[model samples]
Target chain A: MKQEFNITVFSENHIGLLARITIVFTRRKINIESLTVSESAISGVYKFTIVIKTTEDQVKKVVSQIEKIVDVLKAFYHTNQELIYQEIALYKVPTDALYDSDQIENIVRNSGARILEITREFTVIEKTGHKEETQALFEQLNQFKVMQFIRSGRVALTRDPIERLSEFLKERDAFLNSMD
Target chain B: MNKEPMKVTGSEAVILSLLEEGVEIIFGYPGGAIMPIYDALYDYDKKITHILTRHEQGAAHAAEGYAKITGKAGVCFATSGPGATNLITGIADAMIDSIPMVCITGQVASPLLGTDAFQESDVLGISMPVTKWNYQITTPEEIPDAIAQAFFIAQSGRPGPVLLDITKDAQFGELEFSYKKCKKIRSYVPETPVDPFKVKAAAELIDNAKKPMLLFGQGVIISKAEEELKAFIEKTGIPAAWTLLGLSALPTEHPLNVGMLGMHGNYGPNVKTNEADLIIAVGMRFDDRVTGKVSAYARDAKIVHLDIDHAEINKIIKADVAVLGDAKKSLKMLTDNCKKNEHKKWLSEFNKAYDTEFEKVIDKDLHPTKEGLTMGEVISKVSEATNHEAILVTDVGQHQMVAARYFKFKHSRSLVTSGGLGTMGYGLPASMGAQLAAPDRTVVAVIGDGGFQMTIQELGTIAQNKLPVKIVLLNNNFLGMVRQWQQLFFEKRYSFTELINPDFLMITKGFGINGQKVTSRENLDAAVKEMMDHDGPYLLEVVVEKEDNVFPMVPSGASVSHILLEP
Candidate 1:
């Protein structure tokens, strides 16, 4: 029952918060597949996107623990079906392979990849796709003497219309108002 | 409410902020990195009293003790590197036990950070996992805000330790100082709203349950809901059992109070947990020690969990009705919704189990027929001598379990021990803090020989301050708890559990403290009396049976119902 789970957390921009969030997973012995942090759409707020393969029970617990951080505003976990996600990958290939034949060009076109730059030593190709698609392109280009390959961590957005963080903040503010 | 700000050094600003928060005493040690703050402290001796503990670890535990008794955040100070690292144990201890503590550690100058400078350490990174919240202040302007947030986070909601690592440059920097207490943080909400629907559902379950049982923890004391808990129990006439940290929430003599609940808890509470139809857990997590095997623990029972932290709700055992909020408000709401009734038949069942346990374990432990003094007998005598009103601070070991079981509590916050962390060497310094918090109340520290050695230097602090803290050293000549496990599960290898020799009386005498050593039962009463009757600090070392073990133990991974009275 273990499958890919992407956890998204929204928090105030604070120092040492990333360490606090990672320690939750570390303490539980859950390995992080990929992690990415950046400023969200909201001002003074940051978003953390983490990918891991764990059971539903474990993912729920981990998400709850993440939300328990002092600066974290909200946390949510989603499966593949609920998220629209992609990873950007770059492949470096020997320029000689391109000069030898048009096969590499055909492969890149078929894989929906674009050549970013070409030099005497190397040709750089960039692709934005799912992990499997990126890996498939890498395998196909491996025969062309691909010198290097790198992929960014998964960046995702929920399929739902409304931002979950906005809704959470509204409810939180309402609660604070009710307390008064 | 506007006031003119005063210009001062950053170190002075730190003291002014603490004074604004009404901090009277600080447990700390001075070091090169923190010398600036100590220098500023030199002039404010009358406004704030600083007790210089021998080690940073002792200061941490002393702060924990102070916090637990006063229901406020405890404050401790340490320098960078080794001084800050020494406080890691105390910080982790406070984290697990939910004791509110604000730990301030000095760091190298801002420019020296990450440069491998002398006495520099990444205290923020080192303390990240253990602290509830932490921040590093490199500028004097951040001092007031950081300290304000530290206290707010430490004492609010599910209380835990918080650390502030201030660089040396910040301490030396000058700025305009104004103190403002933090009332709220937009990202962090300390109180969870009590859901009426959940409260109704829980009350309905309690009303319909034929045999309902209540399990309370330190949350009861934290929320100051002892009276509410008592009223709830009285309304339902349900049997109540307490966790180790919840020992003093209810008077031991309460009619409905059953006993303790955990690995070495009273037999009735552990055995009856599985039998109860509905388990209303108030402010207590179902720790592994309390629930031996989660799969087999209370399989047929419906659990109603009340807590302030939402993460603890279904982390272990799922709750059929989870009322998430302060226990005081939740208990009151549930009590209002429930009907008045009595479960005498169920109550008698607990009495029956208690009778069996008392006959098999309690009788023999409390009233030994043969040989050396039992830990249980000594604890019982100390309880009697203090009239059960003294605050009992204990270190981790078999002695902690014995003291928790035998000591009778008549008031709240009477028991202070490292329940979640089980930190050794906690009692000696913790007793100092407890004594300082409540000057009129007698503070007795029950420590094992092994644990006593862990923080014995605290004796110098007690001597210098002339703090009246009674120290009861239960010397079994071994690390009894681990040895008990070794004897039962590890085939009695007794590896490194046995200690060599030390003249405890001589050690106390060197520290300028009165002491006595009792070897025979004939002199036990008089020795306890003399120690309790003494005006200043005193240590009473009683040699206990070497091979004795705590009974009614549920072996690891075993069902609570399968608890063993004898190996």
Candidate 2:
């Protein structure tokens, strides 16, 4: 069964790392739904949050393969239930649509979106939610005369009761110390 | 770290680091981007020798051949841009086959990076997918550690090629260099520790198995665990079959050794894979060629996979018991735990299939009555001339399958050819590395006329080096393998598989190499002998029947047991 898996990879801030990681997916013909890279809690290391729809077997294999890369410290995959995730999207609509005021205001308020800026030419709205939810806001705004819109790739945090990176570091330190 | 309190150029550091790693010779070509390193190399003439290959691709393949033959990491160098891109194929070849190679390509000056300067390309970007790990050195200081890391990564853990793209400025810059041999990486685990529990479980399965068989690959040789595998098999008295890379690990004539596996493999091994009660796969990826119709492969068997790479486990065939570790250690543990026993019934089944294949396929091919000189007879003749001891480096096609099926191995690492990638032009250049690494060994490169033409320019490297490598050309005027498939499945439509012609003997002579062409079966044996007897490189072209096809093939997508002996 194909289920959406959110895979988080932690690695060094190395050059060509993104292209390298994506090749693994491209090799397997697995489509990435969303991807975002950002600085992690660890100093000098970065995190890659990637979303893909695949079987549990495939996702496990992909994670293992990704971790095989030299710079990658670790990689893990989780179901949607295991991650607290959100996608942020911004919509730009002509100010003329906001001129009506009542309908646009009601839609914005009902959809839990924020008005980032309003100008004589256009109004910009922001929404932070699940991909489908943010996409719903774009759809509602699309009914109006929307100028342009864009959605940021997914950002995620695992809903882990135990801290993984700390434990991993502790284990790493013990292993290294033993070598001396 | 080196205790010398002196400064050195980055190019000198590169040479020093390679020397520290015990690299004696490198296969490479000098160009604009790498001239600094070549300059340093010019002074260190006593320390290291570099063979200037005609093409970067040839250098890369030669390095792979060297590594494969010597069981050491092969080194090669090239300038960036076209030189680096030229290496991409060989890099991919090494990656897929688990050949250990350290490739250093010189890049444009650091400032010129990403600016589309002359001979500048994103080599780090290009080589990443093909290499086990790759790094760029923009400054002289980083060269030592990066190179140390590159060597470490290339030779350790499921070995493959690693690339270091050093900028020209870095090579020219001066730095107070100190060399630290990287013994360990914090994140990299060279050896995946063998699980005692899994080893115990695996031994129990081997003990309980009634019709157990040991299937081993090049991993046994890679881990230098040949003795461990032999002990395990001898103690267990199990029938063993080999993957292409695994050919020379165990003596082919060993009593319990079965035969090859995959397409164009023997009939018995393929049939018995389904019959065996336990399938113990060690050090081989279950590639599609090996596991034809995986659904039917070893269906009745409880599969036990012992491999160093964890990712390989259950990637294709699901293992009921997975013993993950270095082959030497894991096989040792398993050997210590296994009991002495024999699967006589299983052994007999393999022999039965072998006898049938020998009669139907082996006999006629090796001893032919057809007017034209057959490829099989030629390889068989070469095997005889070399006393089955020569390193048989073969290019891809019907000749490759024929060589694997017919040419025997008398020692470990006797066969050096592209197995996983099946790269066509691998044989001729690879022989250069194999011969350079083991100058005492007689290297015979058996290539098809078609594949030989692909990288035929490598003749320059061989002649320039004055290396003695016997080149056997099976001249059939078509790409035999694809033509066979077309003939069988596509109704005898040869298509564009036919080649016009080439006076190979003249071409080889032009390169100042001894050469001959044998048309009759009577002259075949003497021609092979002459090629082997030559003091330097020799090319012997034996014109064979054009439409001849290799059989005992499991048609694509079919079960291995359902092998077609003849079309």
Candidate 3:
């Protein structure tokens, strides 16, 4: 089945890399559901989270191509399942919904939504989850009327805790253990 | 006296003993003082494959590349003094990553010791900080035992590079012929089983801590305890954060993973490490890079340090509980005794902060609008195609940071980079070695144009053997990393940073390999795909924008909070 794979890239931050990164998806005719880039902790590093529709093989190709970029240090692709995928959806719900009833508050709490800014006129609710979950929450809020709905692209990580360098270190540990 | 050890020199014994250890290959070059070993190698030409590297450094890195992929001890030989010193960077690289390798170097005659004799150096001292163990063979009789011990130590606990420096006189001296079985070195005992009390205490801490974080290090990966870590995380419901060198300990796509920690780590994990009530540090030393400011790091958390090498304990940050044992064993015990604790409130808050921060960085101007390509775009495209599975070997400088920043390694041993040593001219040879070890897997070497020329001589080695390696040259016509430093710290002087190079395409073609030049993003995907599809070696020159700087950089000796953001 054709599925959406979100590629989260952490690389040296620079200009026009986004257009270049998007070019690959566009050229391959893979639909980019969403894409975003941000500054990382390291001054030179930038993190990119992009959602695209394609098969595993296609995603693999896209990832390899992404890795070849001269400025890029690492490119990682995450499927919906393989990653702790999350996207932020900002919704401006009607102000009446916040004060008039407890229904919106209950729904927001259950969905783990945070009220970023509130006023007598409007309420800004932020929800972060799997893209689907975020979308579903946004859809549910449609009944109450949404002033604005925006979502950041999905960023993900594997469930496994062992890191690449740590694995190498652990190998030595195992070798030493066996020696003992 | 036993017919002078059957009429062989110390170097000969070194080679003979390696054969006994089943070393089918040795990467080295003939040099002064080490000629005796080369002579012995000639006799065993048919029995072993000897690859002649352009430099001693190349030999060491190749050995590391080989060992990393095959899980076997990689052997490299170098002559004494300069030869030995040249291999220091690679040696340190292996030490930091804990790759199993044995480096044999020829030393000056014992009489010439401390005399600064021609081509003579105190190799044992020079390599002390970078190696797990080192030995200087003073007598021919001890050659066999020393080499055996070297191999054993290199392949043993937390496998790391071991150095054996044999004096020239020792190599020439006559000794009795006998292969003696090795007994354990009395002084070199590594920690084994976890103390049950400490293990139980650690488990209890994990079971009760409201907010917990696990810091996985290179030690866990070297221990091959990925499954153990996964199981433990699942059982105890702990979130994980790793160091830059610890990229492969857990799959980058794992749910509980908070991404690479420390100064450049993801927001949630880096901050969470400070906020957690209990921090489980496994198989990792508290390097300055990871700890930032020790006083402020994990201030509220109780640290549990687990390691196989006891010496590492209390070397950096003090642990609340130090469990001296293999990480796998300790983690296993902890998992058996621990109960899952929910940190929903903590995790939720962290997730929100992480998302907000991540979005802000990516939403800004990150792409190059000018005619030339930016390093990030090129790397992102390459990563998009490779899916983070290829073995990435990198040369030092801006390209190294660029590659580390962009590449996502999902499996252990997937990325072979010079971390501690940060050696230039490392990418090509390292990639060749990694490819040789994992012939079926893709191996990519990302190097800056300046760094590329430093070891470009290896192009002959790669072409002659037709190794399937993809060399990506990030050409900006300058020593990008140093130049960046000059710009940031030295007032943008740009001293001796410029580089002039032969056409990479033409040069690669001269070596009878495929080559291409990519100027725009439009040409990047196709050009890289072509190289990936090529049957033999391929070189791609990516013309990146000059004067590009990596942001969020923590200036030297500056606090982690003092990050240099791009304007």
Candidate 4:
């Protein structure tokens, strides 16, 4: 089935290298939902996470092509079901409605929200949860006047228990030594 | 045997001349080709503080921040090709904001210039549109004069970015270095004042019109004529509205100052701009955001444009009387010649509209019992705590609008945000640069959680330098601006508007910077005070209402007259 897949790649940083990665998806007609760059544990390395909707074969080919890039060291592909991810949404509703109804409060508690501020006319709220849960909350809250909204691209780590970078690096070095 | 004067490269002459100009700081990095200039830098007196940035882009931004805060030409240097190209965004950022800065880049040797030499890029050609002036120095003798002229152009007129590209060979070759006082520049003649006849015509229009509105732009602030603008508006009792770049030109609390007048502007400002019979626009280009669907904007109004740049006059919107001159000089002349008329009825209507709209968004009693804080409340508390005096720099997003809407900046260049470029990751780096320039002044980077994370790598730069810049992370956990679009235009399909962030507190703590999370308004004051009290760099992760939106929005593709205040 065609589904959305968020692929997070860990690699070294190079100039204009993201363009190369995105071009692969673009040429394949894969629409990227969101993309972000961050630093990784190893010095001089960067992590890129991109959300795209495509089939398994297409993702595999894309990952293989990405791995072939000079600076890309590792590519991790995670389907929506396999990985746990959270997103944030910000909304600005009318301030006058704050005291009139508890509707806003009910929405907050159900969404696992934390109230960030209170002013005379408006309130600012923050919520973090799974993508579906966050979207559900936005849908529920959209009836109120909205001023602006934005999301940080998803950042993820493996949920399963695994050795960290230090141990992984050591093991990889030992394997290379054995091969030598 | 006869002795002669010692010789030095053109690049060396430029450096020596810059030092003579009393430039105490040069933010840059070293690379191939420009090694000669770096060599010369060692022989000079240690008055100039050379900061080695991780990237050339950072150098340019730092220079921009320095210039913004100090009101002087900030200098940055880069080597050819990639380095020059990297500086392009920062150059463009400064250009859009009308900042005074001079960027010097090393080009590949003149002979190998067009041969696609290893690091050679046609930087001057690429930077022409984004710079006030740009030149590639081919000869050794032109270095001193070019350097002098670059500073002059950058600091004078409307104040924009300038670039000087010198060939690598020029840096290696030797020449006698001398400084000559600049008599005058012929090609670059900035407007002095508007024609007195045109000023009289503008005054007559203002006097005769029943509904007169003033549209101010960044030119007023750059010209240091805020007082003159206030006088003109106050004397005429004319209502005024601001553009994004015009935010610093008028005080937020001024009786006639109707905040920003554009797509995301205050309702009253946009309404008045639409309803006015006469509009006196000064120092601002009618940016598309300000005049959405231009055919409908101020269609019935008589438009008078006063700008220092002749090219900007009638560039986008036609002007009834185009007065090409310094904004200050032109406004002063207009005020001097015009008779004072109090538009009491018009002012009352504008005031009523302002209050009605202000009450909706700026009510202090409204409490967000919801999951997140509202963007309005975040800005309200930020301005309240800082008294709106801190150097408030913001990355592009919903947060930029919130700050512009709420923050009351009293000084010129007080509020710095990406206006024309709207670049993300601009806030943190630009704030870092600002704090470096104004070390003692309180500087804050107000960025959305999404925008904050974009350039958070700059935290390393902040931590490394120990610069005390307060960062307010409005953590809504969503790409708040895009989500607004998804809600309004995309029908809440919400394809991917989420961000799961690492615990910001832990993240800040790992960097050894002070970090605090304010979950409620009760905690906000304390957290801000604690962060301010702790000293060094501080990150205040303000978890605001996720669903909160900026109000009085002119719906996308709509005219300034059509605004959506609420659902």
Please compute DockQ, using alpha carbons, for every candidate against the native two-chain complex: 0.81, 0.66, 0.01, 0.01
Candidate number with greatest TM-score: 1
Compose the digit string of candidate 4's lDDT tens values, residues B265-303. 878778777788999998889888888778788977999
Q: Is candidate 1 or candidate 3 better by TM-score?
A: 1
lDDT of 2 by residue, B215-269 (tens): 8999988998888888899999899999988888887788888989989888888
lDDT of 1 by residue, B500-545 (tens): 8599999999999998999999999999999989999999999999
> In terms of lDDT, which candidate is strongest?
1
- Per-candidate TM-score, first chain only? 0.96, 0.96, 0.80, 0.86
Model 2: per-residue Cα lDDT at residue B368: 80
DockQ for the candidate 2 complex? Answer: 0.66
| Native-to-model Cα distance after best TM-score fit, residue B218 in candidate 2, in Å | 1.4
Q: What is the lDDT of residue B400 in candidate 1?
A: 95
Candidate 2 CAPRI assessment class: medium
Please give the distance, in angstroms, between residue B98's alpha carbon in candidate 4 and its true position after superposition: 2.3
- Writing each residue's lDDT as its tens digit, candidate 3 over A1-180 gives 679787877665544456556666766788888877777555566778788877886777788656544345567777777777677889998899777788888888898888999888899999888767888898888889898999887666667785332343355446555765
What lDDT does candidate 1 reach at residue B289? 85
Comparing only chain B with the true structure, the TM-scores of all models are 0.99, 0.99, 0.90, 0.94
